[model samples]
Target: MATTGITPSQDDRSVAELVRQFSEQTSHLIRDEMRLAQAEMSRKAKHAGAGMGLFGGAGLLAFFGVGALVTCAIAALSLELEVWAAALIVAGALFLLAGVVAMLGRGQTKQASPKPERTVENVKRDVGELKERHR
Candidate 1:
């Protein structure tokens, strides 16, 4: 007979012992896999959190940039008039823009209906057709 590398002691073990060893190995493998998954997710979460912080920093910088641009506009206008007058003009223009945008947003909101009109109509039509077919 060809030697399949089974030692005498290993070959002497009962079927139940072999099954128990297999179960133990399977449990260990599952535990290792779970640990690996946990590590991978933790690493990914750390990267995502860092990315979000960077995005927030970028947003803050952009806001400051806009503020700087607005100040520059006011300074340019001040070249022709007083500083206070230039500031007031810019403030008024910004307020006017805000009002216009608010009005447009309100109009769009008013146009949006809570009910799904098209879907409701289609369902009603389908029900009516079913009723006609049954009759």
Candidate 2:
């Protein structure tokens, strides 16, 4: 029988050394998992921010567009009605415009996900894998 110095039997390694190796590896694993989670969360946050920005833009555009439309209508009415009456109509139109914008913005906001669903699912999978491995 021949034994090579390059290969050591499990018994050759000290308990303390094994413990240190296990701890080091475990720490590395945890850090890697944390990095994965952070990356996933960053991606999700970007999407959420973009969605919110879209909603804001939609609201702003709708507000201004409707305001302009109302002003045009009021100007058109000014030819036949008193300026004060046209202004009152414009005010009422403004309220209706705001309601329309609110509805549109609500739809845009509804499309946004406040939760990091992918990260949550990944974390759950990691936890389940770790549990199985530990057991």
Candidate 3:
């Protein structure tokens, strides 16, 4: 059989070429998507790092500020009471502050509940289904 037009072999070649081109284009698209994702992740990571650094700096500042206040209190007490009594008084005050802070934190935690109603219902439904299945 002699074919003058595009034969089966020619059609196959064309289809293979088209598939190859499509594969190459798809590969390029995937690479571009990966690059975009990497860039976005790097940007977000930089932002998170900067935020953490700012929080650490704030914590350091607060620590030093409290130390300075305690030193001032000790000095003020020294002028009125005996040195040991002044130290004891400052220590007692610090303990009281710690106790109050702990109590406030506990109260806040007790008041805070972030339960999801939908999730609870879904869990209950699943449990009921499981119990029915077992029965």
Candidate 4:
């Protein structure tokens, strides 16, 4: 047949040549898939890292905010109570608030999974396709 884009049938290709082509194409496919997985994982890792950084920043800012609030409250209350007593009460309350904020940030950081779930799923699908072709 003189078809413009038709491929030669199996009879036209030697077994060794077919094997070699198959091997080369399979290797290329695996490499391409790995590269894709790596890129996807990199993107996922970056998001996870950003989440952790934000959590850390929030915790730090919360502590600073609590300290500032405690200072302001202590100053205001010192008109009635002695300075040390007012400072102690404000410090204890503010510290509890700071602790709660820190815990919440920790929980959020823990929620961000580092796994590249999408990449794993794609690889699994590729493997399933290959198995189908084999059969």
TM-score of every candidate relative to the true structure: 0.56, 0.53, 0.62, 0.52
lDDT of 2 by residue, 18-88 (tens): 99999999999999999999999999999999999999999999999977887888889999999889989
| Alpha-carbon shift of residue 68 in model 4 (angstroms) | 1.5
Per-residue C-alpha lDDT of model 4 across residues 12-119, encoded as one tens digit per residue = 888899899999999999999999999999999999999999999999999999778878899899989999999998888868988999999999999888998889
RMSD of each: 7.6, 9.7, 6.4, 10.1
* Candidate 4 C-alpha error for residue 101, in Å: 12
Best by TM-score: 3
How well does candidate 4 score on lDDT at residue 36?
100
- Clash pairs for candidate 1: none
Which scores greater on lDDT, model 1 or model 3?
Answer: 1
Clashing pairs in 4: none
Q: Write model 1 residue lDDT over 1-135, tens digit each, in one string.
A: 799998998699899999999999999999999999999999999999999999999999999998998899899999999999999999999899999999999999999999999999999999999999999
Evaluate model 4: give its TM-score.
0.52
lDDT of model 3, residue 14? 71
Better of 1 and 2 by TM-score: 1
Residue 135 accuracy (lDDT) in model 3: 100
lDDT of 2: 0.92
- The lDDT of model 3 is 0.93
lDDT of 3 at 97: 91
Worst 10 residues of 4 by lDDT: 1-10
